[model samples]
Target: MPDLRKEIINILDGKLLTPHFQPIVSLTHKKILGYEALIRGPSNSPLHSPFNLFTTAERFNLSTKLEFLCREITIQRYADLDIKEKLFINASPLVLLQPEFKKGETLRLLDQYGVNPRSVVIELTEHKPADNYEIMRASAKHYRGMGFEIALDDLGAGYSGLRLWAELLPEYVKIDKHFVHSLHNDPIKLNFVRSIQSMAVSLNCSVIAEGIETQEEFKAIEKIGITNAQGYYFARPTAVPVKEIDKALFAIEQDTDCKSAPFNNATTAVQIIRDITPISAKTTISDVMNLFHHNSELTILPLVDDNIASGIIFRDKFLTKLFSSRYGIDLHGKNPIKMFIENTPLCIDKNMPIDLVSKQLTSLMTNDPAFIITHNGEYMGVGTLLDLLAEFTRQQIDNAKHANPLTLLPGSVPINNQINQLLANKIPFGFGYFDLDNFKPFNDVYSYDAGDAIIKAVANTLIQYIPAESGRVGHIGGDDFIVIFTCDDWLTRCKNILKAFESTVPSHYSDKDINAGGIHTENRAGEKCFFPLISLSVGLVDPVSTSQCQSHVDIADLASEAKKMAKKIPGNSLFINQRMAAKNSGNFQSFTHSATKLHIVN
Candidate 1:
C-alpha cells in the first residue's frame, strides 16, 4: 500500500498520465458521437488501473491534484490527436468542491489546447458520497455555464446517483455495465433500461450504455433506442481511436423498427414530400411577402442555408405579425426573413417512417400545417399535415382490411409483408407460431364469450410480454398468434411469455375448476369428459438467412410445422426446431418442452 501511494505521488509529480479514448457511437446516425477520455497511470506500475490510481490519490489527500492533472492531460492529448468528435473528461464532484480546485482551470486548458469548451463534456465520476448536494449542483452548473456539458457517469453504480442526476440534470447519463451485461436475455435488465430510456426521453437527455462487450448487448441497446453507447464491443479504449464507424458493425440496408405501425416500413417521409421551392435566410421579409402573394397556394416558406433547412415561415403568422399594427410592415419590411423564421420547425430525414414523422409533427402542437423535410440533412422538400394524415389514414384502412377484428393485431397480409421485408433486408430473425392448446375443449365447457375472452387474453399477454423493438406481435385469426423476433434472445422472451400465460390464465377459471384443475365438458363424440386448463403452445424457428426460406410462404410453413411439434408436447410448451440443422439434413433436430419437462426429438 505504501509503495502504491509513493508511485501515485511520483506519477502525479511527473504528470505521467495516459489518456485512452473510447468512441461513443450514435445508433440512429451510425456515427461516432464523441469519445470519453479514460485515464491510466504508468502501464507497468501497480497504479495502472484507474481504481487503484484514483483511490491511492484520494488516500494520500492528493485527489484534487490528480483529478486536475488528469483533466489537463486528457484535454491536451485529445486536442493533439486532432479528434473531431467531442471529448468527455472525467471529473470528481468532491474535487470540484475542494478549495484548491480552480473554477476556470478546465476552460483554461481547453483554450490553451485550442479546443472548444462546448465540445468537452465534464463527466462526474463520484468516488465518494457527496454530503453537500448544493455545492455539487452549483459546481455542475458552473461547468455548464462555461459551455461544458455535464454527464453523470456510472449511474446506478454509486451512492445517490439518481439524486445527483436530479440535482445536476446532466445532458447525458451513462448506465452502469451491470445493467448492460447479458441485457438480451434478462427481461429485468431490459425493463430497467427501458425505464431509464423513458426518463431520458421525458427529460430530453441522452443515455449512454457503457461496458458493452457483445453484439447481442449492442443490439439490445440499439433496439431500446438509447442515443449513444461506448464499450469494447465497438473498440477498446486506446491512445488513438478509429475515427469512423466500421460499416460491418451495423446493417447498411437496415429497416427502421416500426412497432406501432407495421406497414410504416414501406411508407417514408419522402413519399409525401411537396417539393416546394425554398428561400434563403438572407431574403428580405418584403420579398417573402411578394413571393407568397404571387403563389396563392403557398402557406409556408421554408428557410434554407447552404441547402440545409434552417427554419420555416408560416404565411398567416408572418402576415399577422406584420399587419397587427399600422407600423408593422414599414418597421419590419426590410428585415431579413430569418427574423420571422420559427427556428424549431420539425425537420426530419426523408426516409423517416411516416408514423414517426406524424408523431414528431404533432408534438410541435403548432397550427402551421407544414414541416421541413431533409435528405441526409439537406433540404429535400416540405410536407404538410394534410398529406401525412391522408397517407396515414389510407395505410390504416388498408391495414384494417386485413387486421383481426377481435384483437386488432395484424392479420395475414401485413404479417406476410413484414416477414418478406425482413427477408428482403437479409436481416436474420426468428419466428414463433402461437396456438392455444385444448382451446376447442374450453369453448365446449365455457360459452363462446368465455372462449373469446381466453383468446383475447392470449393476445394481450403476447403484446405485454413481447417488446415491440425486439419482435412484432400479430394475431392470425382465432387462437393463433405469431411473433417475428429480431432480437438474439428470442427464446428467452418466448419462455417469459409462456410463464406469464401459465400464471395469469387461471384467473379466468371458476374456483371449482381451479380446485379440480380440469373442466367437465363434452368430447368431440358428444360424450362427457374432463378437460385440462387451456394453455399456450409456441413453436420457434430461427431462419439464419434468405437461402433457407425464399419467401413468407416457406417461413409460414416452417413456423406452422414447428407449432404442430410444440402442440404434441401437451400444455404450456415451447418447441424450437433448429432451421440451421434442417438446412443440412433436410430434417429437424427439435427441442420440445412440456409444462415441467424437456424433450429432445431427433
Candidate 2:
C-alpha cells in the first residue's frame, strides 16, 4: 500500500477540518433551537466526511488528535451563538481520555467567541468500544464541572449506549437517526423510540431526536414526546452564521401558523359515524337490543360485510319486527336477523363526518331505522344509535369540562384529579407546571384578551401534541396546565408539547413584540430588561420513590423545583430536578422510607 501516513499528517496540519452544523427545529413553532455539528474533513480531501477521516486516523493511531481538532473548530466557528442555545459537538470516549487535551484552552476559546461552556454539548459517540468506563466517567465529571454538558450520541443504535448512559449521566441524549428516520410509518420503530424517550426522561435527561426528514416523521416524533429534533427536514449541514440561522428559525415559526382550518367540505357515512361506533352485520339482535336497553340513544346499527360495510339496522324497526313475530316463537333458533336483512338499509361511505352522520341518523323517520357504511361501493360496517349516543355522551363530558367560565380549559378540579390519579396508579409521570415566562408584562402591553388568547393557544398546542390515549392534560387555572403521561413514551410526548407551545405562542403577539423576539418590559429592580419572549417552564418529576411521593402535595413540590430549573433557561421548556431521578431509582439509601416511597412513586 502507498504511504498513507504522510497524507494524514498533511490533511491535519494545514487544512481546518471541522464539523458542519445542521439545525434542529421546534416543530410546532418552527424555530431553530440549536445545531448538531457534523464532522467533515478539508474540502477536496479524500477524507471529506469525518467518518472516513476518523476511520483512517484510528487505523494510524491519530484519533485523539482529530477529535481535538474537531472540537477546536466547532467552538471557533459558532462562538457568537447565544449562550442559552446549545452547540452539539461529537466526541468519543477514547478521545476524551487524552490527558494533554486542554479543556481550559477550549473554554478560553469559547469565552473569546462569546460562547459559554455551559452551552457547549459534547456528544459521546460510540465509534469504538469504551474499555475503561472509569476514565470516561472522570472525563465527563471534569467537563461537567467546567459547565460543559454531555450527550450520549447514537443512543439505541448500539448495545453500549445504555451502559454509557448509566456510567456517564449526560444531560442530553441523541437518539440515532436510523430509529427516527421512518418512525412515523413504522409502529415498531415508533414504540422503540418512545421507550427510549421515557427512559431518558426518568434519568432526567433531555432527548434530541435525529434524522427527521418528512412531515409524518416530524409529527410522529412530536406525538411521542421528542423535544429537540435535528435532520434534513429542518436544515442541512452548512457553514452559515448565527444571524442566518436566526432568520431561518424565524421563517420556520411563520410556517407553522396555528390558524384552524376545516378538515374538508364533504358528506359521507364515515363522517356521520365519526361520532358513532360500527358493529358487524353478523351481530345478533340480542346484542343490539342489549346495547339499546343500556344506552337510550342507541338507534341505528351499521352492518359490515367483510371489511366492506353493508346497511344499518334501526332499533325501532328491529323492535317492531320482534313484537310482530308469533308469541314465544323460538327467536334464537330462527334467523331473527333475517327479517331486518330484507329491509332496504341506508348506506354511506366510510369517510363521512360525525356531525353529518348525527344529523342523518336523526333525520331518518322514527320507524325507518338502520344506516350502513360502504367504502368504494362495498359493504364495510354498520353504525347504531347507541354508538351515536355514546359519542354524544363523550362530547358532552369534554364540552362540559372545557366550558369553564375562566381560562376555558379543563378546570382546576380536573387538573388536580389527574395528578391524584397518576399518583394512585404509580405511573412514572411528569408534571409541567407551566406559567407565562413574562406574562404580566405582555398583559400590561396588550389587553387581557390578547393574553387570554395566548393562554388558550398554549392550551390548544398541549392538547394537540399529547396523544389522546397515553396522556391526560388539564388546565390548572391561570396560565398553568398540568400534563400527565405514563412511562410509555412520556419524554418525547412532553418535549414535543413544550416545543409546540414555544413555537405557537408568539403568533398572538403584535409585530413589535415579534420583532423584539419576545415581550419587552422592566423589572422590579428599576432596571430596563428584555423580558424573555413568553415560554413555558415545565417541571418534570418521575415520582418513582416513596420519599418523593409523600403525598400529592409533596409530588407537586418536587415538580415545582423542576419547573423552576426549566424557567432558568431562556425559552419556553421543561426541566427535571436531578435528584428526582436518583431518588426514584433507589440509588440513595439515606431515605428511611425508601421501599414505601418506591411503591408510592411507582
Candidate 3:
C-alpha cells in the first residue's frame, strides 16, 4: 500500500500520465465523430491499468487530485495533437464536488490549451453510487453553461443510470459495453439496445453503441438505426488514433448498410434546411432579445450545445413570457438563454425522410411549427413545418403521377428517375430485374383478374423481403419488377423472395394441377406440353462503377441480358452478371445494345 502511494505521488508530481485516444465513429456518415481521452500511467509501473490506478488513488484519498491531473493532461495532449473532432474526457462526480475542485479550473485548462469548450464532451463516470442528485445536476449544468455537452458514460454499468439521466438530462448516453458485445446473436441484448435507442429518440438525445468488436455486431447496430458507435471494430486506443476511417470499412457501410434506409432519390430533411445560425445555450437572454428586435422575420432561435441541437426558443413565446410580468425583463434578461429555452423542441436528423418528418410535425400539438435540423447529431440548420409540408406534398404529387396504377408502385418513368439518380450520385448498388415464368399460360388458364393477382403478389413479396433503407422496389408493368439494392446482402433478400413466391403460388393453383406438378397447355408452337407452375426469375447485376456504365440505359441492357440468362434455367433461379468483372480482366468489352438504330422518321 505504501509503495503504491509513493508511485502515485511520483506520477502526479512528474505529470507522467499518457493520454491515449479511441475513436468514436458515426456509422451513418462513416466518419470519426470524436475520440475518448483515456489516461494511462507509466508502461513499467504497477498502476498501468486505469482501473488499478484509479482504485489505488481512491484508497489513498487522492482521487480528486489524480482525476484533476488526468483532465489537465488529456486536454493539453488533445490540443497538442491538433485533433479536429470532439474530445470526450471522463469526469467522476465525486471529484467534481470536492472542495479543492476550483470552479473555473477546467475552463482555465481549456483556454490554456487552446481547446474550444464546444469540442469537448464531459463524460460523467460513476465510480460509485452518487446519492446527491442536486449537486451533481448543478455540476453538470455548470459545464453545459460553458458550451460543453454532458454525456452519461457506461449507462447500464452505473448504480443510478436512469436516475442520473433523468436528473441531468445528458445530451448523449453511451450504452455499456456489456450490452453491445455479441449483440448480433443475443436477442435480449438487442432488445435492450433498441429500447434505449427508442428512449433516446423520444428524449431528443443520441445513443452511442460501445464496444462493437465484430462486423456482425456492427451490422446489427446499423439495422437497429443507431448512428454513433465506438468499438475496436473501428479502432483501438492509441497515442495517435486514425484520423480517417478505413476505406474498406467505408465501402462496407456504403455498399451494404444504411442507418436509415433512404430510397433512391428520396427527399430528406437536408433538402429543407434553412440557413439559420444557432445560438449557444449560454447566450444572455438580453442579447437574444436584442436580436429579435433587430430581425423581425426571425421567429425561432435554435439552442446548440457543443454542436448538438439541444433546444429552441420561440421569438413570440419568449417575449410574451418576459413582458407578462412588469419586472420580467429586468429579472430574467441577465440570465442565460437556456433558462427559458424549450428543452423538448423537435430536433430532426438531416437524413430523415421528409415524409417521416412531416408525420412527426403533424403529430405534435405544439403551435411553433418549427424544428432544428442536424447531421449525425450535430447542428446543421433549422427547418419549419411549412417547408416540410411543401416538400412532402410535392413528393406525393410526383410519385402519384409516375406510379403504376395496378400495383401503385413506381412505374417506368419513376424507375428511370431512380436509376438516373443512382448513376448521378455514383452510389454503388446492385440492380435486380424480376420476371415471372409461364405467365402467358397462366393468363390463358386463369384470366386477367387472376393474372393481376399474381403480379401483385410478386410486387408484395419484393417489397416485403427487401429492406427499404437499402433497396427500392419498382413495377415495370405486368409481372416485371425492378429492385435497386444498396445493401450488401441483396442476394439473400432475392432468394427469400423466390422462396416466398414458391410457397404462395401453389395455393393459386388447382389441386389436380398441383398433383400433376404442372399443367398441360398448348405451347407457342401450338403443341401440347407440360407447363410448370409460375415461378420467379431474378437477374442481379453487381455494383458497376460509373466509369463502366454511362447511364441507366446501359444498366438496363446488362440486367435484361442477365434476366434472359436466368429465364433459360429449369425453374426459379437467380443469375448474377459478372460482365463487369470479366471486362476488368480483359476478357470482354462493355455490354451494350447489339444493333444501332438508323433513324427513319417518316
Candidate 4:
C-alpha cells in the first residue's frame, strides 16, 4: 500500500499524464463549440484511460492530487494551442479542494495559461452521487463567481445527477456515451437521453451528447433535437485539436437558445439594440447637431421623455435640415429640438417576431426609416431596415440551405431548431410523425421520382391541414415527416392531415395497383410480397397542460408509438397514446416517468 501510494504521488508530482483534446461541435452551428480537455495516463501503462488513472488514485488516497495535475497540465496545453474556443475541463469538488487551492493556485494557473475565467468550464466530474451536496454546490458557486461556468459531466450515467442539476443549476450538461451509444435503435437509451434533454431545456441548460461515434447516432441525436454534440464521430481526442472541422458532417447550423432569446407565438422579433447613450427631448438643436458631428457612427439620436423614447432624431435627416439653407442651424440652433422631434416615431415591441416586424414595416410609408425597439412601452434601442433584411437573410440561410431538396420543406436542421425553441420556452405542443405505409413498394415500382412526388404531396397536405403561423413541418429524410403544432385544434388538424393524405395519395398509384389493392414488391429482405398502395399513418403526441412533457425526444417517441399503433390499424389511420399526456413526464427525474401510466389507444 505504501509503494502504491508512492507511485500515485510520483505520477502527480511528475509529468505522467498526456493532455488530449476533443472538439465539441454545435449541431446547429456546424462549428466547433469547444474542446473538452481529457487526460491520459502514460502510454503502455495500466493508467492509460482516465478511468483507470482516477480509480488508482482513489485506491491510493491521492485522488485530489491526480485531479489537480490533470487540470494544471490541461490548462497549460490549452493555452499553448492559444485556442480561442471554450475549454471544458473535467473536475469534481473534492479534487478541486486542497491545502494548495486555498491559496488560489488553480486561478493562478489559469492566469499563467492566459485562459479567461469565462472561457473555462469546470465540469463536475464523477460517476457517483456527490458525497456532499452543500460542499459541491459551494465549490460550483466559488468558480462561477470567478467567471467560470459549471457543467455537469456524464449526466445520465451518474447517480443523483439530476439532484446535482437541480441544486447546482449548471449552464451545460454532457450526456454519457452509455446512453448515446447506438441510441439510434435502442429505445431505452433513447428514452433516457430524451428525458435528460427535455429537463435540460426547462433548466435553461445546453446539452452536449458525448461518445457519438457513428453517423446513425448523430442523425438520431439531431432528430431528438439536441443542439450540441461531442464524440469520435466528429473527431477523436487529440493533443493538438483541429480548429477548423472541414467536413460536411460538421456543417451544423447556428444555435438559437430561446431561453435567452425568446420569441413567443412562433414569431421572431429581431432585437436591434445598440449600447449608445441617449439625449433628452429638450436638448438644444445646436447640441444635438454637435453631438451627431462628434460621433459619426451614431445613426439615430433618440429623444427621451422621462426615460421613455417619445421621439427620434435621424442623423442623416437632421444634418440635411441643418445645412439645407446654410443658416438653418442659426435659425433653429438655440431652439429646443422639439420642433425636430419626429411626430410619429417608428416603434415596435422588442418581443415582436421578425416576420411580424417586416409586415409592420411594409404597411408603413416607404420612407418610414429606422424604428425604435421598445420593451414595456419604453424605448430600449433602435433598429434599421438593414437589420430586418439581415435577420431575414440569416433565417433564410438556416432554413433554405439545409432544407430537404425533395419535399422543399425544412429538413432536420430547422426542425431541431424549432423543437429546441419550443422546449426552451416550455411551450406545450403536439408533434405529429407521418409515415407512408407500404411506401417502399410504390417506390420500387413507380420509381424514386414518383415516391418523391408522394412525399411532396404529404408535405403539402400536412402544411395545408396545419396552419402556417402556428406549426412547424419537417421532412426527416425519406418516408418520414415531423410536424410540431401549437393550436388548440391540433387533434382535429391531425385527423384532417391523415384524412386528406390517405384520400388523395391513392391517385398517385397506378391503375393496376389501385384496382388490385396492392403491388407485388420485394420486402427489405428481398422476399416478394404484396405491398399495399401508399397510405398515411399519423402518430400524434399531445403535450400535458403542464410543461412536464419536456423533451422533443419524448414527443418524438410518443409520436412514434402512436404512429406504430396507427400502422397496426391496416389503413390510413391516426393514433394517440392515451397514457402519454398523463404518464410521460420528466418529473424532476425519470424513475417517476412511467409507461405503465401511459394511456394506449387501440
Give lDDT tens digits, candidate 2, residues 1-602: 54567667887787557657787654322356667887777776777776678788888888878777777777877764443557877766566556656557667777777786777877766655655577668768877877888888888776677888887889888889889877767879978987887777557677788887877787667546566788776678877623223333322311221000011111224533434566766676676677878988877666554444434566776677666654122465234443354323544446554444565456544334345555544555565566656665665576566555655666555455545554554444555566668887877677799888888787777777774445556676677777665435665666666666656765777778788787656776766777767776676665453235745577677767767666666565556554655844543211011112211111
**Model 4 backbone overlap count:** 15
Give per-residue CA lDDT, model 4, range 3-113, as digits (tens).
656656677877789999999986544578899988998786667788878888889777777777888898899888899999998877775556544546678899887
Best to worst by TM-score, what's the order?
3, 1, 4, 2
After superposition, the stretches of candidate 4 with alpha carbons farther than 4 Å from their true spots are: 1-271, 325-327, 578-580, 584-602
How close is every model to the real structure, measured as TM-score? 0.57, 0.43, 0.62, 0.52
Cα distance off (Å), candidate 3, residue 500: 4.1
Per-residue alpha-carbon lDDT of model 1 for 444-486, expressed as tens digits?
6778998999988988888887766677888888899988886
Instruction: State the C-alpha lDDT per candidate.
Output: 0.79, 0.62, 0.79, 0.73
The 10-residue segment of model 2 with minimum total lDDT is: 257-266
Kindly list the per-residue Cα lDDT of model 3 for residues 73-105, writing each as its tens digit: 998888889999999988877776677887788
**Top candidate when judged by TM-score against the true structure:** 3
Q: How would you order the candidates by lDDT, starting with the best?
A: 3, 1, 4, 2
